[model samples]
Target: MTEVAKPGVLPARPHFSSGPCAKPPGYDPAKLATDVLGRSHRSKLGKARLQYSIDLMRELLNLPDTHRIGIVPGSDTGAFEMAMWTMLGARPVTTLAWESFGEGWVTDAAKQLKLDPTVIKADYGQLPDLTTVDWSNDVLFTWNGTTSGVRVPNGDWIPADREGLSFADSTSAVFAYDLPWDKIDVATFSWQKVLGGEGGHGVLILGPRAVERLETYTPAWPLPKVFRLVSKGKLAEGVFKGETINTPSMLAVEDAIFALEWGKSIGGAAGLQARSDANAAALNRIVEARSWLGHLAIDEASRSKTSVCLTVEGADEALIKKIASLLEAEHAAYDIAGYRDAPAGLRIWCGATVDVADIEALGPWLDWAYASAKVAA
Candidate 1:
């Protein structure tokens, strides 16, 4: 292949890391509310901001009143772990692993918790058969596979009359998709994901069933202070109402509130989903136009609209690194490298925060990087 000249025009914003992803376009850190800074998280104003953030999330998610939403520590991982530790001992466990995050949960269930969960696994770009899930077992799965760019198509597979609770690790799935809340008893996400807010905090949404499990069932293993959700055998209702188990970063909460307010200004969840879909569509156009590029997830139905991974034809690890480095050095892209655990390729964030123009501009830079890198190799 011949050398392709470096693209002169760059993306207006090249901030596409899959996690701690691109911030909302036109985001000004200076614009974030500073009143909450240095205030005690337990103070009246601090609690109000937290509750307001939760309320905005519920509104955006269209969450039912039967469900409860709370802010937790440790990002999405913490929220999900808190759910698992509190709820899994009441029934059998089933874990579906399709990507790195899913695999981590499987490890937690099998090794850390010693539950010997029924493990159903699939490789990158594929999903385990939803038809095989047993409803009697407490089931856990990632609603979107962040590392592999695969997502569950819909909630049709979950039985409405299932006996066990359904837990969804929805860090990348929320906002980008219309989540069926009735099908999910427990769900977790971090503001840093779709909302592009600061990290170190997670949101946990619990249906009535999950709350019941927490109030009735106790894990055989000792519960960490951060993971405890019950007080005196009753659900710690305060936690759900903005009393977090630990002190939270008021700055992070303020940033999240800003992102949530931004989301509201742009037409709520539907608008956010549309933005992500458009960005994904734009990237897909780039992939479709080039023979050298294709999606890691072959099936369109299960592909992720938020984090979209691309397979480079005949590219090895070194080649993938070269493409990412070249684009970064040229200020055409940043953090566009595929996950370390995923196959060699590029993983571009197509979440709501990214602009479609950036994705469209990215195609030319990718072309230059790939063509030049191939020549260099």
Candidate 2:
């Protein structure tokens, strides 16, 4: 093997982690509004700020008025489970998993909820057959597989008139894709994904059908106060209007606002999606030129644009670790290792917050790191 020399140039910002991703360009912590800090979340100012974030989310996503958007307590996991716990037992269920997080939903369905859902799963690099899915059953799926780097090509598979609700864990796909909101009944995402906001807060979006489920059906299992969406046989309307069930970190909310404003300045959802596409394309250029690096998700159609996973030739867990370590030590990259449960590989965040130039610069650094790691091994 050639002893590749170290790359002279380095990525301007080498933070390629898939979550708690890089903050928006020009993000200055000092610039964030401080008035909301130290105020009770229940105070009028606090409630307005929260509602503003929700409004920005709705406008950016082009979400229909038929759907309700709210800030939930936990990140994506918390929001998704809230949906599953409250509305799933009311009907037949189907769960689809293609990555670690999706598998988590399956586990919850079968074990935690004991709902006996029909499970449809696929290996890391592929999607399950969408044709075989029964629309009559409430279906749960991740809109994007953050770990495996696979995403549904489109929402075409979900029928418009299906009898059951569609629940999507969409942490990494929200700002990166032009989702078919009409087809999704319940969707959850974290602030930390495409927008690169602070973590610990989740956004839950409920379509008309999801609201119907919440108001009409109560699960046989007991509901935690944190998990409760309905109060006295009615959907807790206040929650959708910024009345959170729990106190939220005002700092995180402000951080999200900064990201959202940045997103809007660029062009809202469309602009953010275009930025992510460009970043992914930049990385793909590097991958196409490299013989040793290949995408874990082979099909371009199903491949994810945000958390792009790559398979390194002849890589084992040890080698993968070394590559990640070498890259980090060189400040060429950070947190680029694949998910713990995933196969050995690299996972790069190509979200809107990441500059395309940085991704382009990452190519040589990756080559040098891989070569150095191999030599050391």
lDDT, candidate 1, equals 0.93
Model 2 per-residue lDDT at 258: 96
lDDT of 1 at 348: 95
lDDT of each: 0.93, 0.94
Our tally of clashes for model 1 stands at: 0
Model 2 CA RMSD to the hidden true structure, in angstroms: 0.6
Q: Which stretches of candidate 1 lie over 4 Å from their true place?
A: none
lDDT of 2 by residue, 209-302 (tens): 9998888887898988999889889999999999999999999999999999999999999999999999999999999999999999999999
Best by lDDT: 2
TM for every model, in the order presented, reads 0.99, 0.99
Instruction: Please give the lDDT score at residue 190 for candidate 2.
Output: 96
